[model samples]
Target: MTQQLDFSVGMGKETTYGSPSAVTRFFESEAKAKYDVKTIKGSGLRPTKGVARTSRQSISGFEGSTDIELDAPTRGLGFLLNAVMGAVTNTLVSTGLYQQVHTLSTTDPVASYAIQEALPPIGGGASNVHTFRGCVFDSLEISAKEGAYLSVKLSATILKMLTTGATAASYPSDDTLFSFVHGSIQVGGSLTEPGATTLAVGDAIPAVNISDFSLKVARNLDKKGWNLGGAGLRSRPPVLGKPEITGKITAEYTDNVLRDAYLAQTPLVLILTFTSGSNVLQIAMPAIKLKGEVPTSNGGDVITQSIDFEAFDNGTASQPIFIVYRTADTTP
Candidate 1:
């Protein structure tokens, strides 16, 4: 029966496609079998042009239809089995798991890898392909000046998708998975001196989104309707989508978004702001708990606070965001 494969996960529903275990089992069975076939002949007189015989008894002794003794190699059971095994081996490696999946990696807006670049058309981040797990529909990034209040604005529809499916709906409707962590001090790019800065207290914050960009997934050549038993493959139905975070970063943040981030350790930074000061209060990026809050300065009255964030990696150059542990500044 033709299997109706709908991908809730990794397999091509029904039974046409063999699983990884099937190929593994096939290999195991191939190695253990003992019965084999072979063919050879002994000949003295030639009955037919292609007959297994020689003019003299030196090469082939003599010949008779069944009477001519079969050679050790071609006429034996080993030869027959060997021929059959050859075909089986071809099927094994050709349509095996190793041929399908290769390397796997995670990607985001900061860093990304292509899956379709490996294999086109058949190899897309769609229902048929695997490796697309926990991916969301879209993502965006927004940046703004700092202010007195803590906020992250979302100009882009973070949760919204290209296709308006309910489960994949965008903002002004549901909650978001990605959130902010610790808010901190950012070096103002525009500031010529230390005091000339902006605060993020009253602005919006948008999250760094990582979407359906695959790091790496191999080509499943033998991935048939009931293809390799990958919990990732789907028959006719759709495969699970990769988790995605797409939206512009803004200075506006909802109460829930800010509060939950303050509670959980997931997103790392949730709120950040800057104010006029003589010394550096804190650094923005990694989360850190400190005693006492930094009071806002006004010169008793001008622009009170100002700051903005730029993700940086101390040692590793390419990484946009880095998680690092801090200790006493003994050496410096």
Candidate 2:
């Protein structure tokens, strides 16, 4: 007999941040469900150590945290990105027309969601399904190559964990590939773009050879734990700390334009888009400034510049980091 393999994974958009769901509705709409899942790795129950006078080893306390790794996706990745950045979408209904826009504004508080995965049994028992509750997006890194599909690596923090017999069995629909061929990188002095919302598909930096680019967002999360003479498991919500956003870009150095931008502290806008006929998906970061080390040299086959930048508030909601997804279906 062959062994059972673990493959199915599902997630839900939480109505309330850090609130666990009933597990009854584990999947989202088939059309909007995130399907380009590359990998799911998690940390089981970890214990904090305490020293005592009698024992040689330290004492074990309540479970610390369950950190999970969700590999990045090209298609349908914005849904998960919204959860971590506390980004939200707004639907404007006009005369027989509905427009959906996703935004990650400075004033917006980050949101949370629930994630679960099915694993194979270890010793010929029933399949085990684990659910992570109160899960918050901690950090994310997106890597994009010239011709390859954009890869995303995501990290999330959870408050609690639950295991049960595997029953939910289904996968979401396939996704259209998103790659650097359908992306754009622009550097300017200000966050203001003349026609940002209506940017055409061919609007990108000209004569610049871009090899790769990356973006990282971090929400400094802290957990509270105090001794109160307790017997049962004590759980508290993970507190959000000062958040951070940073990114890097590797490109062929053609001119002194990037160096000039760094010296004058200029802003940059990154727009990655995927389109097939009338369907479109995009991730836009309208306000970002270079704060890291300036590119000197990559010492590679070609003269390349590897520069890092930090995301900043542009003092306007329209200029903030956002994701715009257009499909026939409304829900995501």
Candidate 3:
């Protein structure tokens, strides 16, 4: 019989980029671990050799990236989103027994540390566990479909990877999990329309004929220190490049509202809500500048319109994109 090798993973925010840590938070979902050993080739003529010879390649750098598919929830998903956006929550407002997710900012972001491992043996054994430090979110893709569970895919870049011989004995539990059954979309705000600046709760977009929707957030980060120093990987964090927000929507061609917005360069408001009983998660973009052309096709099933849009800031610090969730966590 083959030996069972059960794995466990944990993550935590790091104080400094490229610094290792024993992550404390555990995620109970599908996770894939990845690591790369960058090397520099030395294929040139030697001093004593007549013909060109090759020498032992030197270890140039170490980097890691991971993709995790998580169920959309209030706690872990909120935490991951805040980390990616480089935002920290400063307030939590609650009424009755529900705690409302306050304004999440993207002013200053920090890296989150993670560990990919397995449950250690009783006393002593070779443990195949790796700890990563200074991890930053590279991209996040969220998808939802009718009669399907809402899920989120998170991609991250890490600085250093340390493979320890043995790991801690136990692991944490992922207890609070939320699905996508209670998802809702509130649309009806005008883009570039006069007297329509903010969106209210009553402007709920009907989802009776909607098929699927997706939202992608990317932090176009530039990985530096690739050719720095002589030996070992560098200990500096990556520089954040231009942040981007893009998404696609698949819905029935109900009207020419979105098409009109795309043509007139209108700025629209979108509020995506996910709720599981009392727990709720909201992704609100106040000023989403429309881009690309609206494509339509007549199929045998139904008439659907698919268009792409990009989120942009309308010269405001705190009004571009807002990620609100219902949790006890005041800060992420």
Candidate 4:
């Protein structure tokens, strides 16, 4: 799933000079879900539902894991003007690059000096090879608009609601074609300005004036045998009214470099929510740490990171029955 993150970064250069101002975007609202859902909208009367039963069984805990891969897309590089052979570094470099060249800024260059410099410059423009699976995210790129930096904060949230179709007796496979909604941005463009702007359906930011957005991860969670009552202080509050089976995972940073680092190996939180009668409740996955981290072979260029997880339980059950993601509004 995708969420809004304010991505802005400057190494010794931008820091010494001045970093771009980061705009804060909160999760506004998502487009009407294609499913048959009942959400609260407008001011007037909010939707009121049933209360949670303290005596019922619930999931107590769980963890998040990850898997990742990377490739230099054709749009980003490969060939150059026939006369000039592009320089290439097989691995990543610690010092970030700008305009396809070594970024000269550094803290103590002598200490973390780049292992290798520039990799062969890849041509820019359309047909850039794209990589995505599970939940697809957007890439960062320079924008034509003014006052905009080139990066996304890179926050991601996923929700897994126990759908009616997925019962205690069912198990899903990689081939299952369930409906999914994802929201995200990579290393390009800043958050949109705040104002009374018109919003599109599924757009995280509302009429503007907020930083960050969220998407539905999974709906219809299930934990047939878990004892959710043990969650004492770790419990998430119930929402009175809203849309979708809301859940989320979020991490924030104005520094694109750091954000990239996190992308390589940062723990992301995922929340799962459910509606029973009139009450809406959520389940939490205690840990979202990545499975591992890998440095580029030569240069310090940050590439891919991954994580792993086994669906958790409230201790009442033995197997993981629920999933989680992000909500449209992240303010609370």
TM-score of each: 0.17, 0.71, 0.80, 0.16
Put down candidate 2 lDDT per residue, 150-252, tens digits, no spaces.
Answer: 6666666554556653446553354455566666555543333323234323244543566778777776666554246522223444556767778887767
Q: Choose 2 or 4, whichever is better by lDDT.
A: 2
Best by lDDT: 3
lDDT (Cα atoms) of all candidates against the true structure: 0.20, 0.54, 0.62, 0.20
Candidates' RMSD to native: 27.7, 8.0, 4.9, 26.8
TM-score of 4: 0.16
Off by over 4 Å in 2: 1-4, 13-76, 90-100, 105-110, 122-126, 165-167, 189-207, 225-234, 292-300, 316-319
Write candidate 3's Cα lDDT for 80-127 as tens digits. 776676653434344422343333234434455655545445554644
Give Cα distance to truth, residue 203, candidate 1, Å. 26
Deviating ranges (above 4 Å) for candidate 3? 1-5, 46-55, 90-92, 95-109, 119-127, 165-177, 190-207, 292-295, 328-331
Candidate 4: where are CA atoms >4 Å away?
1-284, 287-299, 303-311, 314-332
Task: Please give the lDDT score for candidate 3.
Answer: 0.62
lDDT of 1: 0.20
- Lowest lDDT block of 10, candidate 1: 22-31
lDDT of 4 by residue, 1-332 (tens): 11222111111111111112211211111211111122223333324724434344344343221111111111222111000111211222123211121111112211100000011123432221111111111111111111221111111111111111111111112111111111222221222211112111122221111123222222212212223552322122111111122222222222343245345654333332222222122223322333323323335443322212222223442212221111111111
